[model samples]
Target: MTKTRLFHSNANGLIEHDHNRDGIDRRGFLKCMAWAGTGALCLIEGGVLKSFALGTRNASQVQSHEVAGRLTFVQISDSHMGFNKPANPDVIGTLKAAVDKINALPQRPEFILHTGDISHLSSPDEFDTVDQILTATHTPIFFVPGEHDVLNDDGKTFRERYAKNSKGAGWYSFDKNGVHFIGLVNVMNLKAGGLGTLGNEQLEWLRDDVKHLPSSTPIVVFAHIPLWTIYPEWGWGTEDSAQALSYVKRFGSVTVLNGHIHQTMQKVEGNVTFHTAFSTAFVQPAPGKADGPGPMKVPGDQLRSLLGITDVNYVQGRHALALVDASLA
Candidate 1:
């Protein structure tokens, strides 16, 4: 087997080298996880997906030229504020880094979509901190709750703070630039190690919500868990998502965005594209890569290279959204 050198930082600001080890120590592991999650930029133009790395380019160098018939947005997920674990000791710092990148983008996104896990324990202070940090972007944000956000009282605090107008556990929809955006709630009533769920009431609301929209209209769905099954064994996928998705299959263009697994994975079926974003706070092992899903530690130098952001753009008269993913390295 090929050997790899692993390095760690010491209190004296010195680097210590170690031989190949099966796992990283707590400090090094948390540092690695910190580098794993960032925001993303995506653009859809002329029915094509155009993606770019966020940290690779100087945001100031990006000119704000108005492209006719184009709509651009940023997606940031799994901030996990208030998380103080070995996998990531400074969740707030990493999240701030992501915000700085967003504010630096040449063309400001119309809005930002934060998929879930805004807080680790659903604490008011954590939510407040997230809001304060996100304020730097000066952009509106759309959100859905992750399992972590609803830890107490079925998301009472989260709903009060972020989603007051949301219906039936905070599922809602809106129209923007001819695109219909649907936000769903699946973290409620989760089974033990089972998938996320969209109850009967939410499904009924979803069907009626789209009944009046023309099939030609583009549709975007955001949730905390993958609507399509993506590793049921680890509870990464939603349980009754098929019923929820059946309502949008007839649309000409459909895109589903989610957060929860803390990594990027993409799939396409019929007229829909499903994608999951990386976390801003930590990294999780790939499906079946570890005993189960949790924080993943890597070489200190390789940490930032593994985490980054997703960017998406949409152009008028196009049937597809352009998507680009970038790493901080």
Candidate 2:
């Protein structure tokens, strides 16, 4: 297999991804408008929120890095491509807009990490549509599954398309510039907007997967549900994540990422920092803000502004994770 490392560097942060071979060409670009000068899209302007319906702001400040000891990449989750709701009628449109934002960046990410929910209904067409849109970028894309992608069909199609190389029902790991990345599947049979579960077999494999790695190695675990409890009432966390996490507690630096909650919330416990990324599709109500978890209808103007992605970077020789969360609006 060809080995490729993709990284994006900006004046503010950096993201790097090392993955198996895949070639990206320019056709993946989705053109919405033509502009002559580089625009600086405002992520947060004076803390006054803006509408995401218009699309991503063209960023004026962007810088790519040379080969550096440390870098950054992005975490975009829950892109429900086929869903057409008032929250945003065109999720695929927004997803394409996100790709445009990434492609427009001065420094392309080494790769982009998508944490499941690639499709709303697990349809072959839905997956295909998402793939075609993401292919616009030269950056590589890696993925895990959300319950939505695995419902019915036993995740057969999802595994076939995204995680074929993954062992034991689609869970696997890879290394990039000394960082160990683990992608886990925990939403196979998720209840209606409920908790996430990782079966015993996968847990056993997880233990073995990290057994040989030194405790000093930095580890990043990406799944679809929160590995740490966010709100049990919403079924927003993973049931066996504690056991899965136990094996890696010895490691000095561990970052866990998930997307089921559909909002941005973060927590740091000891060496582990748990983050739930916002959805590229739409925002679900915050914990206890609504009756249950589902598509939340926001002002059309505010939707894209609320849609965002998280950027993470590992400092060389240390266990610290520097994070930047940027919104598409």
Candidate 3:
């Protein structure tokens, strides 16, 4: 097994984490992660969240409990379907591998969450190719766009196709087996390497949407960029997320899921659990790992091993939501 490398990010930069052989430290810092290209399964029980790694190297410990809950779902992001760079030439093949992993799960996910970057250049053909491949999962999927996905026409075509039910800029919310899920769009108005923002309209909508929910409701907020500040210099965090997060502050359990950094990250603040899923397309540099955040190259033999898919579960009686991450390798 490849030795797993765990990294922790603070306001300064990324640093290594001390961990046991299995590479898990549930008692460590609130901000932590096993490097990109790994996955996790998440389930919610009694308004709390818990997560376990599903790295292929540790399959023996996770295969059976992956979907152990009332609701099971998976999150796969940043497919970048038309990209052909050396960072990952066969983005298609690796994405297929992600689906294969989901199919092999003991219990299939009820649905899938795609955090965005579905296409490299926002071309119809690119979206078409991505759609063709994803249809194989045989599961429903919900999406919020990334900067790469909203190019050309300001996402008009993208919305018409995937988010007709969504209001302005494709933001919406839904409920599943008791959990309240909010899909947010913060990639709009993006400047080059600039922070993500949720304008006043969306913010108002968010505030109104959850104002009536009970404090015990489990809330899952998914978006394309990190709602919390991960690395401001690299535009890894959101600009108005503070306002967005305030809406759910009363909730007993809040789980925020996102992509766009193309890596895995997690943090706990008060009652909220914020997590970012790894990309299926290509890997990106860690905070300050390179001159800036973009694609990072890995040898072809090691690429598939690094691509990951996240599984999320919501368990009714346990008082927590559990998440496990698994890699295609």
Q: Sorted by TM-score, highest first, which candidate order results?
A: 3, 1, 2
Backbone clash tally (model 3):
28
- Ranked candidates, highest lDDT first: 3, 1, 2
Q: Count the backbone clashes (under 3 Å) in each candidate.
A: 20, 18, 28
C-alpha TM-score for every candidate = 0.81, 0.78, 0.85
| lDDT of each residue in 214-256, candidate 1, tens digit only | 9999999999999987777888788899999899999988989
> For model 2, what is the error of residue 46's alpha carbon versus the real structure, in angstroms, after optimal superposition?
29
Whole-structure CA lDDT of model 3:
0.77
Model 3, range 137-186, lDDT digits (tens) per residue?
99999999988899989989889888999989999999998899999999
Query: Model 1: how far is 230 from its true place, Å?
Result: 1.2
lDDT of each: 0.73, 0.70, 0.77
**Total clashes, candidate 2?**
18
* Candidate 2 lDDT tens digits, 1-329: 11111111222211122121111111111010001011112111222211121223323221222112355677788899888978879998789877877776444567889999999999999999999998887678899998889877999999999988998768999998788999999987555665788988999999999999999898999999889887788887788889999999999879898888777665656667676776889988877778887789989888886677766655566544544456677
Best by TM-score: 3
